[model samples]
Target: MSLYDEVGGAAAIDAAVDGFYGKVLADPLLSPLFASMDMTAMRRKQKMFFAAVFKGEANGADGYMRSAHKRLVDDGLIGDAHFDAVALHLQATLEDLSVPGHLVRQIMTAAAGLRNAVLNR
Candidate 1:
C-alpha cells in the first residue's frame, strides 16, 4: 500500500496537519511567520500537499513546494532552524496520533527531502 493508505489517508493527514499547526502556531519562532496569513486556506493546502507527498504523487513537482514557499524564503522568514522545528512538530503530531514509528520516520524523511526547496537553498 502507498504510505498514504498505510497511514489512513486523508483523515489522518488532516488530523496531523491540524495537530502539527497547533504546535507550530504556539511556537514563538514559527508563529510570527504566519501571523498575517489565512490559516484556513493554508491548512487546506497543507492537507493536499501532504496527501500528494505521501501518496508519491508529487513526482517532478518539487518546484511546486519551492514556489509556494518562495515568499517566505525571500523574506528570511524560513531557514534550517525553522524547518527543524516544523519537522519536530510533525513528528510529535504523528506520535500523538498513534501513527507507527516507522511510518513517522518515513514521513519525516520525505519532509526533510523538501528542505532545500522550502528554504530556497
Candidate 2:
C-alpha cells in the first residue's frame, strides 16, 4: 500500500498537517519563521505536498523543495536544527495518530531524503 493509504489518506494527511503546524507555530524557534505566513494557504499546500510525498507521486520534488525554501535558506533562518525540529513534529504527529512504527520509519526516511533540497543545498 502507498504510504498515503497506509497513513489513512486525505483525512489523516489533513490532521497531520494541522497537528504538525500547531506544534511548529507554538515552538519558539520555529514560530517567527511562520509568523507572517498565510497559514490557511500554507496548511493547504502542505497537505497537498505531504499527500503527494506519501503517495510517492512527488516528481521533481527536490527542485520544487529547493525553490520553495530558497528564501529561508538565503536568510539563514533554516538549518539542521530547524529541519530536525520539523522531522520531530512529523514523527510525533504520526505517533499521536497511532500509525504503526514501521510505517512511521518509512515516512521519516522519505522526509529525510528531502532535507538537502529543503535546505537549498
What do the candidate models score in CA lDDT, each in turn?
0.90, 0.93
Best candidate, lDDT: 2
On the 0 to 100 scale, the lDDT of residue 88 in model 1 is 92
RMSD of 1: 1.0
Q: Write the per-residue lDDT of candidate 1 for residues 1-121, one digit (tens) a residue.
A: 9999999999999999999999999999999989999999999999988888888898755798789889988988788999999999999999999999899889888888889888877
The stretch of ten residues in a row with the least summed lDDT in candidate 1 is: 59-68
**Candidate 2 structure, TM-score to reference:** 0.97
Q: Report the C-alpha displacement of residue 110, candidate 1, in angstroms.
A: 0.7
- Colliding residue pairs in candidate 1: none
- Native-referenced Cα lDDT, model 1: 0.90
Global fold similarity of model 1 (TM-score): 0.95
